[model samples]
Target: MTTTELAPETTGAPTRPGLTPAGLVTVLLGAALPIIDFFIVNVALPTIDADLHASTATLELVVAAYGIAYAVLLVVGGRLGDSFGRRRLFVTGLWLFTLTSLACGIAPTAGTLVVARAAQGAASALLLPQVLSIIQATTSGEKRSRALGLFGATGGISSVVGQLLGGGLVAADLWGTGWRPIFLVNVPIGLVVLVMARKLPESRAHNPLGVDRLGTALLAVTLLSLLIPLMEGRALGWPVWSIALLIVSPVAAVAFVHVERRLERNGGTPLLPPSVMRLPSVRRGLMVAVPFFGAFGSFMFVFAMTLQEGLHFGPLGAGGALTPLAVAYFTVSMLSSRLVARYGQKVVPLGGAITATGMVALLCTTLSAWPHVTILELAPSMVAIGVGNALAMTTLFRIVLSHVPTDLAGVGSGVMTTNQQTSLALGVATLGSLYAALSASLGSRDAFALVIGAVAVLAAIVAITGRRLPDPRA
Candidate 1:
């Protein structure tokens, strides 16, 4: 009855209807917007602070709220898509995202914007999982790998573009508008995606499970218990409530797993299928994803803060600094699928090594130049990280869901994305907290060097851990 003694499941050839040229575009476009929006606000946060005279706490909420809501809802959203139809949920989510974007753009106060960001995050939670589910349900083998590659590539491209665009839009100060354009710009893109979605294929779980209301509620509470404390504890100076919540988080997590197991044992539906957790592909892949994305999320937030506040760089300057990273990611990711096919999961460790080297270079450069670092000095390291990430992302995604059954595509995709999103939030919370605490006394440059050096160390761990990934070629 041991895990190793269990027989492997083989799915010979992909039999499902394939993704069309236009349909692939639709889902990926749907994916790109939310991801771009996720970090687009990073460069714009300073502008928002000045415009609304918002406190540091509220600004942190502006970013944390969206990430938290998105992470919490993703699994349930994926389950809903399985039962009700992915296309329907995707369209609905897109419309909601579009409307919320408009709301964010027009908000008159920081509080209103914060609420809008939360709503937008919820919409994103609905939209994003379907993209993965659809691909999982439809494509298989090399096609699945390629589609997922594009999705990961989209992640890199959109994030950099978001930062770049946010800086440009804020600088343009078009019609005297400032950071509003970052959110407002999504309206048109959402419209195009919605239009394209009409032509996309409609697919869902062939044997869809009913909604697990209890499990859903428990999952949300568990994530919130962890997320709220980590995100707020530092800014609030680690209040008693924050400490209490942090202590409760592991208990809630345990409860969640227990309840889910009981539900599955009783033959009732569960949010996280216990059988899925038994899959090494799913379980171990999660271990790799959490740390990798945690590093990425924290790096984005910390670097953005350092770039603008510490270096006194304009939004444009900060955005431009990441261009090399974006270029390298897009270029390398395009080839990662082939590499994944050739080398299997080894690409992930290789990527982690390269990215770690890049981080080390960045840390050294920052220390050497102090606050006077230029874009030219930063480019090589940025590109190295980009290349490393590109290799890992596409391959890791393929490996994570490599063994998921077609009938459980929604659930599996949901689980992967939920981990991905939650890890990002954790990254922001932990790394960001460390940076904020260190910045209180140390010079910003020194603090940044240490934190980024930590990020490099994180990458190294992920690389070492990545050797455990299920070899797709096996």
Candidate 2:
């Protein structure tokens, strides 16, 4: 089916205003918060365990709960934004995020903190999709391109910044709060964003589809069955339930597809329309997104462990080590639009090649230096990886959403974000588990090298498949 057939009717809402410079900043800030929160806890995990007496299993939940909730609800959040109003949901989400952050900060028990983190994840789901949806609906031509570039940069920078900020906050332990401040810091920032969000011009699908209850439930089950097992299986020793959930995941996924298709056939709006999935840009873009983001997630998780556990780096030291990566990613991402305009689709494969080269450098460094490696030793490889990632990711975002009709902007954004989020969870689960298991047999240095090698292979796959993406300008 063509996008025109799938476009929602424009009957209720009046014409929406274009996004202003200030509005772009407001939405981008909204986008950054959830992504930053996802990685921020990595540096603070040890402190959280010590302070709350959290068990290893419970500690995994601290991360997994947020991710699972965030990933599962993301598409639903987008649909809600399209149905209601993007600005309204954005503001409400910020309010809830602030309160949930406070809840996380003050929780006395590990269980309470886990629950609060899940709520915080839910709040994030409500907020993030609007960032892209608003930009898609309100901006066009060069303005849209630049806005998307900034959005991509925000996401990439936020992931690194999350770790950096987590380390800084945990080390400072302001007012004797220890790890609490990592979450508490969001309270004030969220409030300030809430005020700024007032300036965001509201937009929604003119004839938005009602939420698809069955499709939502099936999608949640599909994700939970898969993610819960991967995230918790390694820590919990691959229990029977974990294996069972893995089996159920594919079954639930098949059912989800059947349900969504049937809904669309019957003239109802499905949660994720098959038409969107059939779009070549969406399909090809996702092929790259899966491996690219999977590697990204695993690299962040495994490298943090390697630094702290192997090299005995403090939180500050570990976070500081990634400084080169953050710098390169921001610098390159800012320049990516112009690069895409000049180089077209060639940029992604070139990025993949560069990323593989960087990973290989990292692998060699780990093998040669072992536990003696320092931040300076890792800087060159990190810089290479960051530059390549910016090229691929920034371009991929533009390519994926470029063809989406404005009427389906929320759905398209949701589909892309959900794919990205799910891949991240899978990467951390699979590669992270591989690293842990290998560390015992191969030793930390070899295990890390082996994982980096695997990541390099994933980057190679991205380079190969990136050739298939249609250039947005075409």
Candidate 3:
């Protein structure tokens, strides 16, 4: 009769054979590890470069390489999970991620480390999409909402915690590994996950399906052409080839859309089905996710650089500043189910307002203490940002997946993850570059803080606008 009553009927199906609460936690943990790794290295980069004698350009490559690869392959990874079994791919991905982390830790040369990081990113691509699909397929109703909130919380907290943990490990220099501990630490955690995952259940489409090779290829090509130039073009002095590749992205993207539509018309399994785009909730949520995630990436990248290079903080001090944010994010995320269920879409706009206020606080802190602000000075802003992020992210995720039929769950998961990852890469490329370009003229400290504040404001705008979107059922 009403939305609340309808949700129970829709989501309350019998539990599958092995999909227990423990199993769901394991999947969420698996999802968090890779995301944590993604941002953890930011605070550790200076130490990594100094110890390995890596060139400045090579150091940038270390971060960009992993992210670019991870972003490019996420869609395909989701498809693989759909065609194969999510549990099988999840276990396989966990083992590979563990091995690659070991490789990264042991790598002697900068080149070797870069290669290992690329492998790690690839492994992550395989692992992350399955986490979402597993949750989507297994849980529903309050259970689904709670699980998704945890996933969102884990993602937000991982970015902050990764930096903090990286800093601590580098400072501790555990096992005489120096910067190596950052990567090595994942090995034991990953191994534990692998053992636990065996108890995880298998989940596939209700009906088996064929892989979409052409759609996958086109998606990869389109993303690569876009991110590669944006990440490296400036470092390479904007080479002719870089410009050419940048130009090719839109063309490739258009071609990808045409091909997918044509294939879908012919009764083919397009990587991204045209029909899904017609869903108002999925389409609008995605539009907001791109810019929102972009800002999140930029904030992490730029803030880490500021704390380290501009303020002369050590790795630990730089990372410690974000701890408050992480704690706040976790608290709010754990409580998100109650808030969202009651408030519905209103939760998103409120989050934006909160986040915008946090940015303002951060801006003030930077201006007042310019070259001497302590971690304590940044705490207020960090907490606000965390709370706001928890609210916006948890709500956005639910909206995106709300209308997905069980049959198309994998593709839905893939599309959402792709949007998030691509936007993250874009955030770092666009905002990081702008900060660098303005550093000399505006001064690094002032320019960095100003740029992040501006972007945060922009993100808040997008979030508020997202509140106007039609509900998923409509």
TM-score of each: 0.88, 0.88, 0.87
Q: What TM-score, to 2 decimals, does candidate 2 have? A: 0.88
Question: Per-residue lDDT of 1-474 in model 1, one digit per residue for the tens?
Answer: 000000011212333456787899998888888867866788887788889987555676688778777866777677677678778999999999999999999999998998999899899878877887777666778888888677767877787777688889988988988889898999999998899888766776655567777777777777778877776777778899999988888888888899989989998868678888789998999889888988988888888888888887878888888778878887887787689888999999999999899999988887788679898998899899889888887687778778887555556766776677778777877878778778878968878888998999999998999998999766
Residue-wise C-alpha lDDT for candidate 3, range 1-474, written one tens digit per residue: 000001112222434773688998798789888867866788887788778987545665677667766766766676677678888988888988999999999999998998899899888878877786677677767887888667766766776678688889888888677889888889999999998998887777555445677777777778778766776787679999989998888998999999989988998867678887668778988888777778777787778778877887888997798778878877887787688788877787788788888888898888889889889889999999889887787677778778877566556656676677667767777777777667757888778877877777776786678788655434
* Angstrom error at residue 145, model 3: 7.6
Task: After the best TM-score superposition of candidate 1, give how far the Cα of residue 227 lies from its true spot, in angstroms.
Answer: 2.1
- Candidate number with greatest lDDT: 2
Candidate 2 lDDT for residue 62: 79
Q: Write the per-residue lDDT of candidate 2 for residues 317-380, one digit (tens) a residue.
A: 8788776887888788878889999988889999998999999998888778877888899899
At residue 135, candidate 2 shows an lDDT of 78
RMSD of each: 4.8, 4.1, 4.5
* Comparing 2 and 3 on lDDT, the stronger one: 2
